[model samples]
Target chain A: MKLQKPNDVMLQVSMRVITLFIFAFSFYLFLAGHNNPGGGFIGGLMTASAILVLYLAFDMKTITKAIPFSFTTMIGVGLLIAVATGIMSMLFGYPFLTHFFDYFLFPLFGEVELTTALFFDLGVYLVVVGAAMTIILAIAEDDK
Target chain B: MSNLVILPIIIPFIIGAVLIIFAKHHRLQRVISGFTAVGMLILTIYLAFLVYQDGNIVLEASNWPAPFGIVLVADMLATLMLLLTSIISTACLFFAFQTVSSDREKFYFYPFFFFLIVGVNGAFLTGDIFNLFVFFEVMLLSSYALIVHGGTKYQLRESFKYVIINVFASALFVVAVAWLYSVTGTLNMAHISQRVAELEQTGVINVIAILFFIVFASKGALFPLYFWLPRSYYGPPAAIAALFGGLLTKVGIYAIIRVFTLIFYHEPTFTHKGIIVTIAGFTMVLGVLGAVSQFDFKRILSYHIISQVGYMVMGLGIFTPLAVAGAVYYIVHHMIVKTALFLFAGATERITGTTDLRKMGGLIKTHPVLAWLFFISAISLAGIPPFSGFFSKFPIILAGFQEGQHVISGIALLVGLLTLFSMMKIFSYAFWGKQKHTSEQAKTPIGKLLLPIVPLVALTIILGIAAEPIFQYSLLVSEQIMDPSIYIESVLKE
Candidate 1:
């Protein structure tokens, strides 16, 4: 299961444009996650897809070596973060999975404020990326 | 309160993480897993009794406010499922102790098993739909590994299909969650119910409900989506088979019950009361036919898992408290007896080296203990008189009649009789006829190998003898589920 060769020039150019658009959209989604529609899940998927396209186009062996950490551990860490965000409520005298309060502020860039839900969404983003990558890569390795 | 919500998942998860480092040492891994399983059982039972006294325990993770943060709520339904999972996990682990080879056990099986329990428990307890999807992936990924643990040609081939289908289902799950969030603007289950109630029953919600149903239907192995269970289950050893048989489908059932009764109750005319009954009846009839067609001992049991799920779902479709309570009670009884029955198949297979009923005979004379235990569970599975299965079904059928669903009632009755016939076929072919095996092999007897099934066998009888209190408890669970305002208020209350 060697990685498929990189897509030719036309395909690569189209993929690059798509990747850039996704990155910008994903950032917007993550920034507007709280009180608005988008969040970390969409953002994470966008980022992961961008990475995945590159990996699939370039060699997987190169992609595998380029990564700095294990996808499975990233999943574990993501889940732990998600779970930990929920656990933080208990420390402040709430029940399991109770979220702390939040505040909203509109800034020059956009509305910006800290919310535990943002943390939860981030955790979700990580899990989605970790799980997708793990399954895809594991299947690829198995084929090999 | 936290103990009630998080302990069940946390202990198994911590132990599972630790086992990864010790995966090479079979003996050490077994000892740790054994201790963890026993701990989980004790914790689950104590928690069940706690819920019995104090009502449901809703733990908001990290003490966040409700409707804003995720919650892990333990109502009677969650605790009951947890108790059954712990029981099945313990029994299956013991059976695995005797049967699974050291080489296979050493390959991170114990850790993966623990992780699987974490996913199962999380799925039952989660208060958010998206979080449920996360837990589900956690569970299924581990299952993918465990199912093909040894990487046999058959295991790999079948599990690949299983993995691909579930992956696709999970993608649909995300899609559904995204759509739901767009419509309701909330992911908290209780909050979704509250919001959906204020809005009109739009066509969009109906489409979303069907989408959610499709995802769970595939998971639960409902009428049109059940082809994956039988073949994929055949890949694992008996112990894992028993675990999957007992708990996995129930998770799907739990999700169905939770969503339909809580969030989707806003439009029962289109969603809950109508679709559930229609699909459930078909699920029961078709599943039994599949069972009747199969000759393999394990295959028959696997098919019956689908059929029995129908009865539980039928109770839900009835929409009356009596019927729903019956479904809850039926779930408890079925999970226990079904796991025991599968373990018995595993033992018989261990002794005879074949699951094909045509390949062996007359086990009652040589291994009377195994035969009798199998007999009790089989009879219970068939819903015979004096067994918990019958008691559970009686209320369901009575509730069905009371609700004027005579056709469904009639189908359920016919399914019950066919279930009895399928179980009897196994009893006669594998236990009652002439001894076809060599004398030396017969002397080894399946009796010693069958000891792990003793506790579950005893549990079936106990459930039968103490049917009154348990049935009353089921009534309470159904009442709680039906009037979920209490659940929502507690979770969302400031």
Candidate 2:
């Protein structure tokens, strides 16, 4: 089950670059999710893949040094954030997970609309990323 | 007030997340989880009281209208089940505190336990079918983790089967939900019921109903589908096995009762009488036979869970108010007693260091207290007089006779007799005869373990002595369920 490393240096460099691009695109998907197609689940998977690419390009030891925090903590935080948004709505005398949206006008930007659901989606994104990484890392480590 | 309905589901979810962070601090994790379980129990009891007084309480999630958004409903049955779930889970948690290894504790057992609760409560409370599927996944995912927590070879092998079977059932559940949605165009239960009533018993509707039954019955471990239960359950620690024995299949039973009564009642003769009654009869007969053949402590009890579930479904099959009431009563009684019995098994295992009845003996001489406690629960499980099991079973059998289902009632009585024989087999072999392993056995103090079992044993007795009020409550619950109009109007407001 040893991971086969590519001999070519160009492959590793290109993988790193592609990983960054996917990470940024996932963020874009997550932010535009409330009004558009992409949301937390897909965005989170994209981010996890970026990390996965890093794991693929680098050795397990180097990747562990790069990401020091426990992946499970990300899951816990993501779940807390998602549940907190629901509880926040409950605190405002609304049902759980009831989203509220409002638009504000700014001098620099024309207008921006914010929704509580976006934060909920962010929480979902983090959980997906964390859960995916946990499984992948565990499997990869087990192979070693 | 309606918001209270969602608290049972949410409180656990929040606690589970928090416990994940404190996973390394075992003592702190125990304290936090203990307080949360107690708090949730109190909250569930209060909610049950409110529902008992004020009829059904429905909370539309995110302020979505009834049919348009997800809702959590706490009617008599749901709240009743919620109360029972909280009681058993709390007991199991405390029992785990005494018995679960520190290694498992550090591996996030408490978090997964709470998550399992979140899933169970969510399954009982959700008003939408799709939400039920989601909650089932949550429960199954945590169960998959918990069942294999120790990662023993036996645990790994058995849990793999358990996971595969449940995953298949879950997929079938989603397919059933999708088919029903395609047919009825609504996911909300009450709305679907209304549509089902309007559509009458079309062949497509009946097919969908049968599909749903197969999905839940597999989860509930009915007859042929119960192959995964005994071996899989035998692999986990007794505390986990107890929790699964007590609550997991009952969730499936709860779903069956909810859907059959609310949405698929139009053709009782075929679905309830023909199909369910037949399954109930076989489930009882085969389950008891399996139990009678088992030579291990937990394996026998695991088989008995399937057997006892047959009685509950038989009550539903009888399809009378008294019968359904009896089924409800049986659920409450069975959950408490079965969990207590398993906890007792765990305590005995701790002392003797084995689950094999052949290798274990003289527990009655060594630990008279544990022996007596097991005796009481065993007899109660066997439907002996002056215990909760007898009273709960009495109504179902009586109702079966009254309804002229003589053969099914006769089968129920016969199964009860076999159940007694098997329990006594366990008693004599494990507790009574010569001290088979007395020289090798350690006299581990079980005071902490006994703490959880005592309340459950007491509750079983109280449920028996105070059967009048409990019976009346079950009747009220049955009436509300038997007549779906109340549930529909309360939820949909049309």
Query: DockQ, per-model, please?
Result: 0.26, 0.74
How far is B211's C-alpha from truth in model 1 (Å)?
A: 1.9
Clashes of 1: 18
Local accuracy of candidate 2 as per-residue lDDT tens digits, B114-194? 999999999999989999999989999999999999999999998898899998988899889989999999999999999
lDDT of 2 by residue, A105-141 (tens): 9789779998999989989998999999999888888
- Tell me what TM-score chain B of candidate 1 gets against the true chain B: 0.98
For candidate 1, the per-residue lDDT at B478 reads 95
**Cα shift from native, residue B23, model 2 (Å):** 1.5
In the range A1-144, model 1's lDDT, one tens digit per residue, is: 777655477766687688788778887888788778888887788878877887766667767887877776666567667777756775665565566555566677464467787777887888778878877787777764
lDDT of 1 by residue, B236-287 (tens): 8889989999989889888989988888877776675688888999999999
Pick by DockQ: which candidate is best?
Answer: 2
Give each prediction's root-mean-square deviation over alpha carbons.
Answer: 6.1, 1.5
Mark the regions of model 2 whose C-alpha exceeds 4 Å error after superposition. A1-8, B439-442
TM-scores for candidates 1 onward, in order: 0.82, 0.98
Instruction: Output DockQ, candidate 2.
Output: 0.74
Q: What share of the true interface contacts does each candidate keep?
A: 0.44, 0.77
CAPRI-style grade of the A/B interface in model 2: medium
